[model samples]
Target: MGNLTNAVTIVTSASSGIGAATAKRLAASGARIVLAARNEDKLKGLVSDITEAGGTATHRVTDVTDPDDLKALVGLAEETYGPVDILVNNAGLMLFSKWEDTAVGDWDRMIDTNLRGYLHAIAAVLPSMLERKSGRILNMSSVAGIHVGDGAGVYGATKFFIRGITESLRQEVGVGSGIQVSMVSPGVIDTGWADKVSDAEGRKAANELNKGAIPPEDIADAVAYALDQPTSITVNDVVIHPTN
Candidate 1:
């Protein structure tokens, strides 16, 4: 149970939900946090909370869908706290709609924010990690990635892509490189993501299923567990679901 003291950790979508909770927990464990999300005000609030608790923090307003923004995110981490020791690719969208309904905009947004954004974040930090041979990348997938059902087709595809890349990256990095890659799959966590469901039927279904959903901190705990582990131990493919 090693602490993350002085670790330069970047968390995307850190304004709320799992990202925000994870930032708080990591900051409590003594990690210097770099928060990135679309919400600058929320990011500032988080920075204030962390700093008030005696934890160091910085923030950037980033859109994960943009390569430039992600590059700047990693750049800020480097300039502020040296090379990024860890990256939590947490920014994502879950615009659930029926496949046959032809929600092209929703699908495109998902591809950009969920799939392509994940790639961009990795590409931004990987070179330095490769050069240093020491870093961690933890991508947040969803249980739907492994088990797809109604209203989850496109979203599931994105999570599956994340899982695939996480595995591929871990192996590509090889052993003795000191780089760790992990994936987390959380089921039905309580967050504003549910409201993003545009389809009437899909939104109703999601709302019904999300009843009694687990708190975001539960997923955050899983992230903290992975990051706190030794470099030799990569906590990969964590699946967390509510018992109720």
Candidate 2:
């Protein structure tokens, strides 16, 4: 836990939900957090809230789908605080529709945001992290990545890609580089993500799932745990599921 003190971190999709909660939790533990999201106003508000609470924070409006935007985000963290010691790739989109009914545009958006976006962030930061020989990358996946559900075929595929990519990257980085790559798979979280479901039945089902859903803060605690571990101890995967 003390290892987190004064550590620099970047959390994407940080305007709300799990990303926001994780940013606050890390700040509370003495990490200087950089919040990245598409919403500038929300990012600023979060930064203000953390600062008012006596925790250090900064932010940049970022669209993770854009490689250049990701590069600028890393630059902001470096210039404002220092080199980022941790990167939490938490930004994602969930568009649920049956395989036969899914629109091409929606499918493209899901792949671009959920899969390619993670790749873009990794590419933007890996050079510096590898050069420095130290860093932690925490990718937010989901239980859906493991178990398929109705109307979530494409969304689940995207998350599955995240899991696969993170695992392979972990092996590639290995134990010697001082780089830790971990994946967090949360199940039935209480977030407004259900609003994005196109099918009314899917939306209702998601709402029902939320009846026993874990809070975003629970996942935040998991992220903090991974970040706080000793440099040599890499937690490759963490799954947080609510007990119904």
Candidate 3:
């Protein structure tokens, strides 16, 4: 295992849940952090906590769905710190709906945020990492991506896409350069995962699914583990779930 000292890490959707927890975990390791999310106020709050704890941190109001916004976020990180050593794509929206209900709008939101948003962050950072010849890209997937469950069809699809693409990306970028890629797959977590379930039945089911949910910090630890691995060893996929 390695350490995170002095690495410039950019975490998207950093306002809450896995994103927020991961930012704190990485920051505690002495990594300089850039927190990005749509809620500027919340981002600042987290930044304050990190700084007060003696970790270097900054915030940016970023919507991962916007490619330009992601570009600007990376730009800010570069402008603040020299070059980004780690990029964490943690922004995702979960609005579960049964296919029979055909909630087109919810479907679009999942695709745009969970899938396309991941792509946007990767696109924003891959070039700079390539140029630097060293970096880490950590994509957040979920247990739902590993196994499809009822009432979460499209959401599962997006996670699956993340799992596949992250592995493929690891192969492509981690060849000779010091660059590395990894995926963190977590099961039901208590914070804000089911808040957007619009369909009544789907919403109820989604809530129940989180009954044995683990804390978001658990997943954050998993992300830190991936980043802590020596560059000679690539921590590709990590799956963490409540055993219940």
Considering summed lDDT, which 10 consecutive residues are worst modelled in model 1? 169-178
The whole-model lDDT of each prediction reads: 0.89, 0.89, 0.89
Candidate 2: minimum summed lDDT over ten consecutive residues — where? Answer: 95-104
Alpha-carbon TM-score of each model against the true structure: 0.97, 0.96, 0.97
Candidate 2 lDDT at 43 equals: 92
Q: Write the per-residue lDDT of candidate 3 for residues 1-244, one digit (tens) a residue.
A: 2468989999999999888999999999989999999998899899999999999999889888999999998889989987989999898877777889999999999999998899999999999899988999999898989899998899999999999999888778888877888888888888867767888988899888878899999999899999987878889889887888
lDDT (Cα, tens digit) per residue for candidate 2, span 83-140: 8889999998886666676567778988999998999999988888999999999999
In candidate 3, position 214 carries an lDDT of 91
Candidate 2, residue 60: Cα displacement in angstroms equals 0.6
For model 3, the superposed segments whose C-alpha errors exceed 4 Å read none
Q: Count the backbone clashes (under 3 Å) in each candidate.
A: 0, 0, 0
In angstroms, give how far residue 122 of model 1 lies from its true place.
0.4
